[model samples]
Target: MNRRVLVPAAVLLSSLSFPLTITGASVALPDLTGDLNASPTAAQWVVTGYNLCFAAFLAFGGSLADLLGRRRLYAVGVSAFLLGSAWCAVAGDVGGLVAARLVAGVGAAIATATGQSSLASAFDGAARARVFGALGTVLGIGLAFGPTVSGFLVDLAGWRAVFWVPAVLAGLALLLCPALPPGRGSGQRVDWAGGALFTFGLGALIWVFVEAPVLGVAHPAVLAVVVAAVAGVAGFVRVERRAAAPMFDLALLGDRAFLGYALVAAAMMGLLVPLLVYLPSYFIDVVGVDPARAGLWMLVLTVPSVLLPGVGAALAKRSPRLLSTGAVLLASVGVVGLVGIGPDGAPWPALLLTGVGVGLTTGVVDGLALSSVPADRVGAAAGLFNTARLTAETVALAAAGSALTLLGGGQPDSGFTDALRVVVVVLGCAGVAAGLGAHALLRRVGR
Candidate 1:
């Protein structure tokens, strides 16, 4: 294959595996609980473990790619992911599976952190925009089909089959590794101290978000984690400012346009990811659909995602600010549409709206973030952009889950409906606020 086709194909394949693991694993959770005799907490970790590690190590992975050669790191990451997947497939208990997932998440972090930058290195100008759009298309397809595929796999082969899917994808990605253009490491030495502080800070922060809903935000343990996370983040900022080669370029934050684009990415993820994670359950438990059928229902949110990336790419060429503002506003309308969802409610309209909003904004915003940074620093910039997006997703999930628990009042039916309404309303407001904020920020930058 041509290097142009080969590199992006490999990166897209690797990128596709991450979301597949996320959505497919969620579908497998009930089966895992039964097979492993796991508690709700343990099952939750099956999802959280991967996300936590992925978020924590993302910047490290990107920095490493910049320092260690993107192709080499990409290969290493895929091999690790394949090994972790095989481990998960064979694990006998939830604890073992969770542990395996942590390993897989590390690999995912490395792969994802480098995936876009690799594309950036490979293509530029109109070609870059199209490739980025194509990358977005891959993401949407993975998310759209993940559940349905996992559902069939689980029904046919069992939950372990879900693990095997990513394993196979990783193996194929590894085969393409040699085709990637040679990547040179940045000559700068690794900032180990800065990396450690940032990792621990982000890790603690994510932990608090993941645990707060279960433990109560005011609980001593949660409070302690919060303080530690805060201190670690503050210390990390101090360390980065003083360090010769910081993991993140603190200087980039000064560019209001860059910051605005980053915020748009983060905010879009905050609204979209939680819905993807939770809506399948709503379809099953609330709408009384079987798991397999619920997967089909999820298409309402995911299908639009697959169809709109090209539109977003086209819009980006004309005006990214317009793309960001319009998409967010449209997504807010979708969220509002979701406010009254129930057993008899037709969710497809709201789902389509939300999906279109997210799909239209993501690629354009991602392109903006990448293009705003220096070429050599693309890896680091990708890490920072993704970190912010994932953090927002983690926090949104925690907050939404907590709201559900509080509003549900222990009643499975009515309580869940009430909780869903509350969460939808909040997400809607957030979408509007993010749209307006991005618009205002971009205007300020223009001024």
Candidate 2:
């Protein structure tokens, strides 16, 4: 009931909405394709556009919040997101839908950029941990619930309903901002030039990666995009080094522990997001389940993901290295189990373990990422963490599309095996790295 708690309470809603929309759309895309008259390639953009923009601008969003007032930006972002969702809900065609998704992504970046800073500005060590724990729970649940929730909405009301849910949440966040404390930023100059360069660079790179599957990696458009992306990055780096106040302080990467945490987050995302991306494909194509039914099965995988964080949060406080151990163990076991899955169809229990593993890793990873950085640098830490994770997310989603195209075996069984194997190997390696990271930080953050 305290306004202090109300801040994260409101912020958590925004965090929850991010993944819900991200994962929810994947499950609903099948229906969306038909209703919107979209092609397979265009459907990919529905998800890609959101993530591309989310990653491109998230760091800048954080800096902007620090420069501008958090309250002002939160209101701005939530309103924009709400308005975008309205557009998506009534979008008439694939082009309209993709554009709406891009708009929604911009809104999400605003909310995410400021959400953690607001929480940190409002709370301290132990309380911060608890709020973060709850945020983890919210994230896990949003992702876990997205498929099932979207499925129900799509089945009962239509795909448009999925867009409306997050829209309403954003609108409520806008209303609750008045109850929150005043923001601390003094409206410093935002690195618009730096932000523009980074946006163009990252966007171009993802554009190429996303199109590779459909366009052929060797296609002229793909090559051109890749070139533009590289040039964009070079330009961004040069620009940032000279900017009055760069959007991202590349110097932050000089902090070994901080960079390690960011990499782990990236690796964790690379490991899990891909698995989730491909699972829907298996449910629909291999299992021959309809979109609604496939979504239900996918939700089964996410249930543990939704709840494990609450447990992991408590454990993380008890042992700085505890979640790291569990992250490695769960991911290994889950991926190894997946390696044995065959064309006959996956066993239900194996599927469940995979989801459990995902939840375990995500929860612990989130906790460590924030805890490892200095208190004053939570903004940089949170921004770097989100950027790395979002990059992995964009990669994972695009890679699945690319992997399937290359490994084309005409069956979801073959596709699933191919995709899961790569993810399993990747996560297995990440688990080891996370363990090393925990060990390195064990003495640093000394219990």
Count the clashes in each prediction. 0, 0
Model 1, position 374: C-alpha lDDT score: 82
Can you give the TM-score per candidate against the true fold? 0.90, 0.85
lDDT of 2 by residue, 1-447 (tens): 678867987898878778878776877776777788776667778878888888887877777787878888887777778887889889999999899889889989988877776787788889987887777678777888788788778778988888889888887777788766668788688888888998898788777766677778899999888889899889988998888777776776766656655655565566566666666656666666666776777766678776675565666677645555555556555655666655555666766766665666665665576666677876656666677779777866676555554565324456656765665555566556665664564445434
lDDT, candidate 2, at 266: 66
lDDT of 1 by residue, 203-270 (tens): 78767755666688899999998999899999999998998878878777777788888888888888
Task: Give the number of the best model, judged by lDDT.
Answer: 1
**lDDT of candidate 1 at residue 181, scale 0 to 100:** 65
Model 2: pairs clashing at backbone N, Cα or C within 3 Å = none
